[model samples]
Target chain A: MRNVKLTVAYDGTNYHGFQEQRGTGLATVQEVLELCLGRLAGRRVQVTGAGRTDAGVHALGQVVNFDAAGWPIPVERIPLAMNGLLPGDVVVTEAREVGQDFHARFSARAKIYRYTIWNNRIPSPFNRLYSSFWPVPLNDEAMSQACDHLLGRHDFKCFQASGATVKTTVRTLYRAEVIREGTLVHFVFKGDGFLYNMVRIMTGTLLQVGMGKASPDSIRNLLESRQRAQAGPTMPPQGLCLEHVEY
Target chain B: MRNVKLTVAYDGTNYHGFQEQRGTGLATVQEVLELCLGRLAGRRVQVTGAGRTDAGVHALGQVVNFDAAGWPIPVERIPLAMNGLLPGDVVVTEAREVGQDFHARFSARAKIYRYTIWNNRIPSPFNRLYSSFWPVPLNDEAMSQACDHLLGRHDFKCFQASGATVKTTVRTLYRAEVIREGTLVHFVFKGDGFLYNMVRIMTGTLLQVGMGKASPDSIRNLLESRQRAQAGPTMPPQGLCLEHVEY
Candidate 1:
C-alpha cells in the first residue's frame, strides 16, 4: 500500500478547524478532504493532517497523508481530482507517493507559522478577514528585538494555552522574526513543534513589547517564570497562519 | 454646508457596486455610506463617488464627498465615527474637510487601478476572493509589451463594454504595466479616466498575448478598429481594485 502525501492550502474563515469533530456537524478542512479522498478511493479513507489549526487560522502549505491502497489514480493527478471535488475554501496544491510508514505529523522536522497584523489607525477592509487589526502604531524594531528571546531551545510552557497534555513543555525554536511592509506586520516563526496557542501568545507578548508596555527583557523573565498567566494573551486565530510543514 | 471628503476601502464581496440604485434594493457601497452619513447628519444627504466600481470589485483608496452641513461632528474624527457605523466590509480610511466646490468625480485628475491574477496551476484559497485564477503559464514579458500599446491618449471604444453613457470614449492612459511577484501577476493602470470595463478588457487582451494566442501588436490593431468585439473578454470583477485617485 502506497502512502499518498498532499500539500494543502485553505482559507479557514468558514471552517471550525483542520481537525474533524465527528457527529458534531462542525465543518472542518479534514472532513471535507476525507470526503473527497474517500470518493476517489472507493472506500472510506482515513486522512491525517500535520497540524490541528483552529478556526479562522489560514494555511499556505498544510500537509496531509493517507493510504491509497485501493485508489488506482495516478499520484500526480490526485491534486486535480481532489480540487475538482473539494470546496473553494480548501484545495490540494500538490500530491505525491510516499513510503507507507511516513506519517504527516511525526515525520515532520519543523513547522513555520506567520501572524499578520494590520498596523494602522483605521483597519483595512480587504485585510480584515486575514489579519488582526491594531489601531495604535507598533514599534517593529522593539518587536524584532524581543523575538530574540524565543530563539534556540527553551521551555515554552508560559506561551502555551491550557488543555494540552504533552510529554514535555520544552521545544527548539529555530527562527522568529518580525517583518513590516507599509502598514502590514508579519510575525514569522519556525520551530520543531509548537504548543497549543504558543505562536499566538508569543505574538501577543511581542505586541506588548512593541507598544512599550513590556520591556524586551521581560520575555526572558516570562520564560524563567514558566507561568501561563504571566505571559501575554493569545492573539486571534485570523491573524495566525500555518505557512509550511517541513519533512 | 461644508464639503467633506473621504478615502474609503472595501472588500466588495457583498456589495453590488459603488453606485446606489434607488429602487433596486441592491446593496452598494454608496447606499451604505449614505445611510451611515445620513444618520450622522440627522437628515438625508447625497454622496458623490469618484468611481462606480462593479460588483466584486474592491477599492483601496476610493474617493467620495458629501455635504455635511448639519453634521457638526469633528471632521478629524469622522473616519472613526463612520467606521463604527459601517459594516465590517466597508470603512472610511481617511476623512477631511475640503473646499465647498471640490467634487469627488469632477475634481479628480487621475485614477489608478490594479488587477491581480493568481498565475499558477493551483489557485490560492486565500487569494480566491481577491484575485483572478489563471491556471496556465503566462509570458509576463509579452504581456508587459502589450501594455505599451495602451499608454497615451486613445479612443478606447474597443476595450469598453456596452451600457456606459459617458460623453466621450477618449481617455489618456498615463501608465500601463505588468508586474510579477512569484505566482501573482499584477496589472496596474493609471489613467485620466476609463470607459466601462476598459481595464478588464485590456487585461484580457494582454492575457491572450501572454498565452501566445495573440501578438502584442494586436492591442494597437484592436484600438484602431474601435470595435468592442475585436478586443477581448472583460476580466472578472473580483480581480479589479481601484487603488488611488489623484486630484
Candidate 2:
C-alpha cells in the first residue's frame, strides 16, 4: 500500500465541518477526498485529516492522508483529477507519497490558527461575511496584553467545548499575538494541540479584555478555575481558519 | 433635499447582479440599498450607482447616490443602520451629505475595475467562489504588452455587450495594467465609461493574449473590427469588481 500525503485547502461555507458526520447532509473535505481516492484506487478508502474544523471554519493548509494499492494514474495527475471531480470550494493543492506510518493526525507537531476581525465603524463590503465586524473601538494595547495570559502550557478546560473527548485538557501554546493592520485586527495563535472550540473561546475572552469588560488577569484566573462559566462567550466560527500544520 | 454619497462593498455571490431586474427574485445590491434608504427616509428613494456590475462580481468602492428630505438618522449612523438591515455580503462604508447636484452615474470623472485571476494550480478553498482560478501558466509580459494596445480612447464596440443601448461606443481608457503578484493576476482598468460586460470581455481577450492564443496586434485589429465576435470569450463575472468611482 502506498500512503499519500496531500496539502488541502477549502472554503468551509457549505460544509458542516472537516470530519464526516452522519445525517448532516453536508459535504466535507474528508468525505470528498475519500470518494476521490476511492475512485482512483478502485476500492474503498478513508481520508484522515490533520484537524477537524467546525462548520464554516476555513483552511489554507489542511493536511490529509490515504493509503491505496496499484493505482494506475500518475501522482501529478491526482491534483488535476481531484480538481475536476471535487467541488470548486475544496481543492487538493499538493500530493506526494509518504511513509506508511505517516498519519495526518498523529504525525502533526504544531498547528496555527488565525481569527480576523474588521474593527471599524463600518464593516468591509467584500469581507463582511468572512470577518466579524464590530463597531466598538478595540484597545489594541489591552488586547496584546491579554494575549500574554495564555502564552505557555496550561489546562484549557475552561476554553474546551463541553462535549470534547480529549483525555487531557493540557496544551502548550508557542505564540499568541494580536496584530492590528489598517482597519482590521488579526489574532494569530500557534499551539501543539487545541481542544474543540478553544481558539474561539480564547478570542471571545481577548475581545472582552479589549473592550474593558474583562481584565487581562481574568484569563489566568479563569484558566485556574477550569470552569467554562468563568470564561467569556464563544465567538463565531466564520473568522477562524486552520492556517498551517507541521509534522 | 440632501444628497448622500455612499462608498459600498459586497461579495456579490448571492445577488443576481448590481442592478435591479424584472422577474428575478434574487436580490441585487441596488435593491437592498434602495430598501434601506426607503426605510431610513420613511419613503421610497431611488438610488443611482456608478456602475452596473454583473452577477457574482464583488466590489470594494462602488459609489452610489440618493436624494432624501429629513433623513431620520445621522450620517455616521447610516453605515451601521444599512449594514444591520442588509444581508451579510453587502456593506456601506462611508456615508455623507454630498452637493445637491452630485450624481453617482454622471458626475464620475473616472472609474476603476479590477479583475482577479488566481493563477495557480491549486484552487484556494476560501477564495474559490470569489476568484477565477486558472491552472495554466500565464505570461505576464505578454499580457502587459497586450494591454498597451488598449491604452487610449477608441471605439470599444468589440468589447461592449450586445444589448448596450448607447449609440456611440467610443470611450477613453486612461490606464490599463496587467500585473502578476504572488498567485494572483490582477487586470486593472481605469476608464471614463465602460459598456456592459466590457471589463469581462477585455479580461477574456487579455487572457487569450497571455495564453499565446492571440498576439498584441490582434487586439488592435479586433477593436477596429467593431465586432464582438472578434474578441475572445466573455469571462465569468465572479472575479470582476468595480473598485472605485472618481468624482
Candidate 3:
C-alpha cells in the first residue's frame, strides 16, 4: 500500500465538521475523500484528516492522509480525479506520495488557526456569512497582552468545550496574537493541539478583554481554574478557520 | 432633504439582483435595503444604486444613494441600524452624508468589476460559491493578451444580451486586464458603462482564448461585428462581482 498526503482547502459553511457521521446530513470532507479514493483504488479506502473544524468553519491548509493499493494512476493525477468526483467546496490543493507511516494528524508538529472579526460599525455584505461582525470598539493591545499568558504548555480545560473526550487537557500554545488590518481584527494561534472549541473560547475571552468586559489577569486565573465555566463564551464557528498545519 | 451615500456588500447566491423585481422568485438586494431603511427612517425610503447587477452576482463596493425627509441619523449609527434590519447576506459597509448631486449611477466616473476563476484541477470549498470552478487548464498568458485587445472604446453590441433594452451599445473601456495570482485568475474591467451580460460574455470569450479554443485576435473581430452571434458564450453570473465605483 502507498500512503498519500493531501493539502486541502474547504468552505465549512455546509459541513458537519470534517468527519463522517453514520446518519444522513450534509457530506463531510473525510467521507467525500474516502469515497473518491475508494472508487479510484477499486476498493474501500478510509481517509483521515489532521483536524476537524466545526460547522461553518473554513480551512486553507487542512491535511489528510489515506493508504491505497498499487494503482496505475500517477500521483499528480489523483487530484484531478478527485476534482471530478468531489463537490466544489472541498478541494485538494496539493497531493503527493508520503512515507508509509505518515499520519496526517499525529505527524503534525504545529497547527495554526485564524479567527476573523469585522470590527466596523457596519458589517460587509460579502463578509457577513464568513466573518463575525462586532460593532463595538476593540482594544487590540489589551487582547494581545492577555494572549501572552496563553503561550507555553498549560492545561486548557477552561477554554475547552465540555464534550472533548481526550484524556489530557494539556496543550502547548506556541503563539497567540491579535492583530488588526483596516476594519478587520485577526486572532492567530499556533499550537501543538487544541481541545474541542478551544480556539473559539479563547477568541471569546480575548474579545471580552479587547472590549474591556474582562481584564488580562482573568486569563491567568481562568487557566488556573481548569473549569470551562471560567472562560468566556465560545465565539461562533463561522469566523474561525484552520489556517495551516506543519508536519 | 439629506442625501446619503452607502457602500454596500452582499453574497449574491440568494438574490435575484440588485434591483427590485415584480415577484418573489428570490429577494433583490434593493428590496432588503429598502425594507431595512424604511424601518430605520420610520418612513418610506427608496434606495438608488450605482447600477444593477444580474441575478446571482455579488458586490464588494456597490454604491447607493437615498434621500430622506427627516433629520439625518448620524453616519456612524446608520450601519448599525441598517445591519439590525438587513438580512445576513446584505451589509451596509459605509454610510455618510453626501451632496444632493451625488447620484449613484449617473455621477460615477468609472466602475470596476471582477470575475474570479478557480484554475486548479480541484474546486476549492471556500471559494466554491464565490468563484467559478473549471477543471480545464487555462493559459493565463493567452487570456491576458486577449484582454489587452479589449482595453479601448468600442461598440459592445456583440457582447450584450439579445433582450437588453439599453439605448446605446457604445462604451469606453478604461481597462480590461486578466491577472493571475497562483491558481486563480482575476478578470478586472474598468469601464464607463457595460452592456447587459457584457462582462460575462467578455469572460467567456477570454476563457475560450485561454483554453486555446479561440485566438486573441478573434476578440477584436467579434467586437467589430456588433452581432451577438459572433461573441463567445455567456458565462454564469455567480462568478461576477461589482468590485467598486469611482466618482
Candidate 4:
C-alpha cells in the first residue's frame, strides 16, 4: 500500500462543503475528488481532508491523504492526470508519496484561514462569488487591536457554532491579524485547530469592532463568557478561504 | 427628453454579449439592462452600449445612454434602483444626465481594454472565470517589445475578425503595454476605437511572441498584410474586459 498526500485547490462556489455527506446526494469537494480518484484507481478510494470547509468557502492550499493501493501513476504526473478527471472547480495542485504514518488530519500542525471583505458601498459583480460585501468603512486599527485578544491558548466556545461535537472547545492561535489594502479588508488566522464556524465567527466579531459597534476589549469578555449567543453574527462563508495547512 | 449616461460593470459570464439581438432569445447585457430599466420607466427603453463586447467578456467601465423622458427618480438613486431590478451579473456603477448630442457608441473618444493571462503551468481554479491559462513559461520581455508595434495609428484590418462590416479599418492606439505581475500577465490597450475581436487577436498574437513562437517584429508584417489569416488566433472572450471609455 502506498500512502499518497495531495494538496488541493477549489473554487467551492457550487459545493456543499469539503466533507462528504455520504448518501445525502449533496455535492462536495471530497466527494468529487474521491469519485475522480476512484475512477483512476478502478476501486473505491477514501480521502481524508485536513479541513471540512463550509459551503461556498474557497481553498488555496487544502491538504489531503489517501491510500493508493496498487496505484501505478507516478506522483509527479498525478496532478495532470487527476485534473483531467476532476471538474473545472476542483484541481489537485500537488501530489506526493508520504510515509505510512502520515495522516492528513491528525498530522497537521496548524492551519491558516483568510477572510476577504470588500468594504465598498457599491457591490462588485465580479467578486460576488468570492468576497463578502460590507458597505461601511471599517476601522482596521481597531480590528487589529481586537485580534490580540484571540492569540494564545483559550477556550474558544463562544466562537464555535452550535451542534459542533468536538471534545474540547480549546484551541491555540499563533497568529491573528486584520490587514487592509485600499477597500479590501483581509483577516488572517493561524491556529492549531479551528472548530466549525470558528474563523467566520471571529471575523464577524472583529468586523463589529471595526465598525465601532463593539469595543476591542469586548473579545476577552466574550471569551470568558463561553456563550455563543454573545458572539457577533456569523460572516458569510464565501469570504473565508482555507489558505494553508502546515504539517 | 433627458439624455442619461451610465457607467456599468458586469461579470459577463451569463450574457451572450452587450448588444441586443432581436428575437434570437440569447441573453445579452443590453437586453437585461433594458429589461430592468424599462420596468422602471414603464415603457420600452433602448440602451446604446459604448462597446458591443463579445460573449463571456467582462466590463468594469462599460458606458450606456438612453432617453429618460418624464422620469422622476433622481439620477443618483438610479444605480440603486436599477441594480435591484437587474440580475446579479450586472450593476450600474454611476449614472448622470448627458447632453442631447451625446451618444454612448458614437461619442466615445477613446477606449481601454485589458486582457488577463494566467502564465502558470498549473491551472488556477479561482482565475478560471477571469483569465486565460497558459502552461508554458512566457518571456514577458518579448511580449512587451511586441506591444510597441501595436502603438499609434495603423490599419488594423489584419487583427479584425472576418465578416466585420466597417467603413474604415484604420484605428489609432494611444497606449499598448504588457505588464507582468508574478504569474499574471496583463495586456492593456487604449485606442480611439477597436475593431471586432481586435483586442483579443492582439493578445493572442502577443502570447505567441511571449512563448517564442513568433518574433516581436511580426506584428508589423501582419498589420501590413491586412489579412486576418496572417495574424494569430483570437483569444477567448472571458479574459477580455472593456476597462474604460472616454467621451
Model 2 segments beyond 4 Å from truth? Answer: A163-165, B163-165
The 10-residue segment of model 4 chain A with minimum total lDDT is: A121-130
Tens-digit lDDT string for candidate 1 (B134-156): 99899999998999999999999
Q: In candidate 4 chain B, where is summed lDDT lowest over 10 consecutive residues?
A: B83-92
List chain A TM-scores, every candidate, in order. 0.98, 0.94, 0.95, 0.97
Largest DockQ belongs to which candidate?
1
DockQ of each: 0.80, 0.77, 0.68, 0.77
Ranking by TM-score: 4, 1, 2, 3
Q: Residues A133-176, candidate 4: write the lDDT tens digits.
A: 89898888899999999999999999999888889999999999
- In candidate 2, what are the lDDT values of residues A29-89, reduced to their tens digit? 7888788788777788888899999988988889998875678877778888888888888
> For model 2, how does the per-residue alpha-carbon lDDT over B1-247 read when each residue is reduced to its tens digit?
7898999999888888889885777889899999888877789898999888888998899999888667778887888888888777888888889999999999999999999999887787666656788878988998899899999999999998777789789999998998788998899999998988999999999999989999977888999999998898888988898898999
Question: Model 2, DockQ value?
Answer: 0.77
Report fnat, model 2: 0.93
True contacts kept of each: 0.85, 0.93, 0.97, 0.60
lDDT of 4 by residue, B152-234 (tens): 99999999999999999999999999988888889999999999999999999999898899999988898999999988889
Q: All predictions: root-mean-square deviation over Cα?
A: 1.7, 2.1, 3.2, 1.2
**Model 1 chain B poorest 10 in a row by lDDT:** B159-168
Q: Give every prediction's interface RMSD.
A: 0.8, 1.5, 1.8, 0.9
